[model samples]
Target: MTADSEISEQPIEPATDVRPVDSEVVLARGHLHPAILLLRLLDAMRQSVVTVVAGLALGLPWLLAIAAGMFLLQLGYALARYLTLEYRLTATELRVREGLLHRQERRIPLDRIQDLGFESTILRRALGLTVVLVETASGSGVEARLDALSRSHADHLREVLLEARREIVAAQQAEDDAITGPGTADASAADNSTATASTAADEPEWLVHRSTSKELFLRGLTDLRLSAFVVTGFALFEMADYLGFLTQMSGVARGVRDWFAQFDPVVLGLLLLVLLLVVISFGVITGTVGNLVQFHGFQLTLRGSVLHRRFGLLTTRQKTLPRDRIQRVTIEQPWLRRATGYGVVKADSAGGSRAQGEDTAGGWDVVVPLTRLENAFALLPALLPGLEREHLPWQRGSRRLVMRTTIVGVLIGLAGAAALWSTAGSLALLALLTIPIWALLGILAFRNLAYALGDRFLALQHGIVGRYIAYLPTAKIQSVVVRQSPVEQLLGLAELTVHVAGGSPTRLPDLTIENALELRGELARIAAIAAARDWQTRANATATRPPADRVGESQLDPAAPPAGDRRPWTEPRGDGPAADEDHDRPGGAPPDSSRPL
Candidate 1:
């Protein structure tokens, strides 16, 4: 056939569903909104409240004007920043460019992107904007936060970025297979392309689950932080009085103090008891109400490989965690929640941040703040997909676990009683009551201690007043430790700890020494296998790239040097007819050692 006819006869391949990789594409640009500037201003003020209050305390008219000027300057700067903020997307990277005085460009590879979350404060949400937080597995607690994007745009961007990551992974797997050998028939590129096409097509996404207002309210009520907030609120109230904001209230407080000073011993005791009761009541009310506001309409949504959580009362927080990025899953059930058959499910990821208190804002993101135990169990498969769930054979602690715990609790109780003996005399004997209570606690804790080994996960369950179940992927485990104390040595019991990338290690104590050691070996073997597979996969991917010069196919050598020699692949060698053929082949020249061999 003539060249023109041959060209026309060759069928043209159809275009792919995915976009071509081009750095010039502007996926979305962030436009500054007045509400965003206002939110930023408020956040600044909240962060520097003490400085602002001090400036106000100077009581100078000029200071007030200066503060106003400063606020305006900050607002103007925020506006400028928002105007400069823009992001671009390519097949492999998400590029963010922003700066006023100095130019900055951030290019995050899609492969490194561990999470893509969309958060919105009440003001932003009202304005139809979302704050997109991009977390990479860089081992840095910091995340790239893009503010003032429309909610729809943010969601779309998140979807595109995640799909791009999946595409990259699929391409890499194909390359790896090409190098190593053919992959399974099911995992072929044609199948993958077809699946990608269907997914990219107009497939309606479904809502996985959402938290009810009642469930969130119950979560807030069960929050242990509620107890601590009582003290914080009292301190704030005292600060307000000291600042002269509540002159009338301060007078009442002084009057109460005077009344208390004049009370007899028995009356003073009764007043103290009443004060404690009042404080407890106040704490309960404040804590529960605060939690209710913070998690008013918490919702969990799933779209393919990503799980998104949207929550908040004042500052609506949205967290997106990739199923593969999750390092561990913890299910916590306090006595109260357990009694009501409710539990909280939390997930820890490699790129997650540590938060204080209940960690509602941290990396310990709550998958389900409050749900029925059975429902929570059912929800796990959805949250962490691709993993098989099985009923593992649990290894219960020995009876010695109970005895050891009782002895330790008794010692602690005795120490406390002895410390109080000189001050309270016979009344100190009342402290002895803690012994039985602690013993019962120890017994309950021992009873709850159990662990099971899954094919790819380690499940640990423990706790007394509260029940904790931690599921750790064997592949993510950094190390396993088996420790024994002197007492434990005599009893042949040990503690087993499984450490992951970040966060506290999950521990199962009072295991038999034999069992703990056996577990350690098993974990080590699994870790080794996982590491080897990753290494081989990476090498295969690297080796599968097409040669730069197609004319010199002979130059693409395939054999490795003998074990004793450490020569490079391109080094000249006498390796039989293959080497001679490479040297004499048409359109090929001798290997160049000067050029990096």
Candidate 2:
């Protein structure tokens, strides 16, 4: 109202900086396109089908009435999604406004956004529509999603989000204007800031990274994870047979059932043995074939915040996961890779849902394209550039002990095999072979297990079958544990487990006592830096604390977290924007993605 108001009326000057000051911001894409409505319609239909199927499975009484009810309900809901959902991207916020009679709205300020992921199912891809997932500040429980927009629109939206976030950060840092030297901190900060902003805009710069559709297809074709998924699918059916969820609907299952139904008591024992063998065989085939399918011709691209990967022949898919949503990054190579000087890169993204009780998400959205070991450093800034040091290395003591323990494990496994064969009979053939595979796997585990450090970066690479490389800031670590089992105790061995929010521990086994504690302390220090969210040095800080009642109402009570919860918060490293605006959210407010900052 004073001098500032009088100046505001003046004509604008062309300034170099286009950034914003507040940590909170409005979005860039606002109009709800028809395609987006179509996606909501599709989702409503799918949910309706699931509900109906569930009812039938539970034996709903009055079949015809139930069927009729389901049809009407589904149709009604789908129609509602089409008419009511309004996905919007504003200048400073991503807002979801919807309602039939009573409208509702939820907004996410760009600065608090952690990630964005694009997903395209076969149908959605055909429709040229994709989903944009947004990960928010709290890192757990609630998320916002833009259900349906064309692939190009989704990409553009990602860019807008990035730009907004950067503007906010720039404004916040306007005061001190602290600029670190170009040598170290500069590179790391630039990487994170760039990743955070470019995820959306990065795609446009693809003239430099343009991949042919064929390349994307081929990349998907030989993806080890897909192959692993296929193989594991078979195993899951076996597990389901044991626990009774999903089952093989093939002739073999039918034959087995018929035989069991018609068999005499004398044949039951034989039948049981056959079933057990089938399970073991399935597991073996799954493990082997999955390796073939998943990593056949893997290739990955790292340009800006987008990490693009494609692998699969029959049901091909290509994905571009923005760096901001990269909750955890991992690099893994079998000892085979050590020989080739090549490794696999897999990232933990926000889109996939976790199978309850499992260490990793059952259907995690992963990008597996073969990559170079050295590139690990190059990609560090984008994924997590706030690591304590310039470089992180493998825990030497742990690696050595683990390698030695592998050799010893072979000796013990052989002893066990001999005893087991004497008692269990010929089935022990597989167990006997385990002695060698274990030794080999152990050797590979030790040889392949490595952690590379880069300025403000920590990268973890391990595993043979299910290899992974995780990128995380020291700040992301919630806790560190050092434990030893009796066998390890006798051998002066211990295990170090660093717990990040909502992820399985990176277990480094058979480490010396001194190394285990040392590693823990080192990680903790890094975490301290990451958690250092001091705002004092900033020109300004803009934060959006949702209405208190709404925040409390929407959040998962921290007191009642998922069981065996690792992090005190236990929020995994995030969700994308797809679920950001939840006027139609099932519960009060969905959990903000549990993710790295």
Candidate 3:
């Protein structure tokens, strides 16, 4: 039977209170809005348009038939999916069931939910529909997507889910306190604030940041890169060739060259310079227009624990990221942006993947896309409550790091010179000129390579022409490794890599071996404590569940101590090297090798 036939015609009403009285009772259950079918059909048509055009141009009847068949198949599948799909919201989990020939079901625990985002294309908006995306800590990016729901229903669902999650977390925290006495004063204060926030009839939202047209223009102006110009030139050339305009362009080029041939050398050089300037101007204008469209009417607001971002002109997007889910926040000041005193702030949450290009158009991780340097730093405290930009105790790497980088840069310059020797002959000597530039870059890099470890955060600063400062919460660190390459070992230096949930691992290169080990151990200890606290909360929550539903205590967390073990979580597990012991062998280590701790 179709979901529409089985379910009532009336939509599920929003819950007055999402707090759990019974775990198994359904809070809401409904099928996707009927408009989903139209959206799906439109998508199918869009996909087939190219095929249909190609078939018509090639005068191939069979190709048209194939395209028609594909369209029909897609329409049939969409119909089947719409008819079978149903979602249920319980106190403990959000359940989705769908399928016809093959049955499928998904049960996402309320506590694991990290984010709920809304998106609407021009078509969807006109139809009063929205797409809801659900994310978890599963690391596969979006875990579930509910397409084309009524806007009101989508908002109601988001509210229900977030409220339910908050209730669950609060209950877990109370249970934790019963066992562990009490948490830190800051945690207690946060819990109180959360409680106060939840008691309100409506969660008040405050506008945190808004991008003006001027800021958007500057963002695009400074977003320039040589790669963008090269790509644009290549694309234009290919298009000209494909459209049979290359010959015309070549004739024009020949005419211009012949005209220039009659001019003096200095005049030709000046003309060439003007042409280059014009090309650059064109690129910058194009880029600026693109950004203006993409970020028009951008706004960021804070509602309770979640940050809500809304932007885009043609396709409006609304992204909700919980402050607690943010694993890392990076402030980027590229050369041009730095020169303009502007910077961009991006965040990595446990809900999304970095491979998805979180900073690109249509992605949701940019907290502050563009702002003045001081303003950008000032906004961090709002996103990360306890962060103090000026108070961080930054520490630079050893001077050996500078020497090592300089040597590597010089070697690269020499290699380039050697590679060009045969082609450019005497002109190859110009390659050696890069050595001074490389040396300067090395010095700049060393100056930028600094890290600060705070009680609750780890801040890393690095880069040469640009500056990047990443702030990572200690509780979010999954693993810490100290790695020593052969050259690093010779220099008595090592690199530290800290792994978090959703983004690339953060690296601090060129630290003394002793320092690397010390930092690794400290981070590991902090992670262990966090893991233990998480375990206690989970265990307590599981205790209230039925025996069959409860998770196995020993399997709760690999990094956590086993259930009923009374040992302090901060103590070493004795599975690795001692803190005071030497990491190297009795003699010198082998060359061109590496090891991870």
Best by TM-score: 3
Arrange candidates by lDDT, highest first: which order?
3, 1, 2
Local accuracy of candidate 2 as per-residue lDDT tens digits, 346-444: 555443333222233222344544444443333433333232123233332354544455657666767777778988777655565655666676655
Better of 1 and 3 by lDDT: 3
By descending TM-score, how would the candidates be arranged?
A: 3, 1, 2
Worst 10 residues of 1 by lDDT: 545-554
Give me candidate 1's TM-score against the actual structure: 0.71
Superposition error at 595 for model 3 (Å): 37
Local accuracy by lDDT, each model:
0.61, 0.48, 0.68
What is the Å distance of residue 197 in model 3 from its true position?
A: 8.9
Residue clash pairs of candidate 1: none
Question: Which has the better TM-score: candidate 1, or candidate 3?
Answer: 3
What is the Cα root-mean-square deviation between model 3 and the actual structure?
13.1
Question: In candidate 1, residue 156 scores what lDDT?
Answer: 80
* Clash total of candidate 1: 0
Query: Candidate 3's residue-wise lDDT over 245-350, tens digit each?
Result: 4334688766655665688989865765565667788878987988887887888877655577899887888776656667888888887886787889899877
Q: Where is model 3 poorest over a 10-residue stretch in terms of lDDT?
A: 585-594
* Local lDDT at 203 for model 1: 35
Index of the highest-lDDT prediction: 3
lDDT of 3 at 266: 93
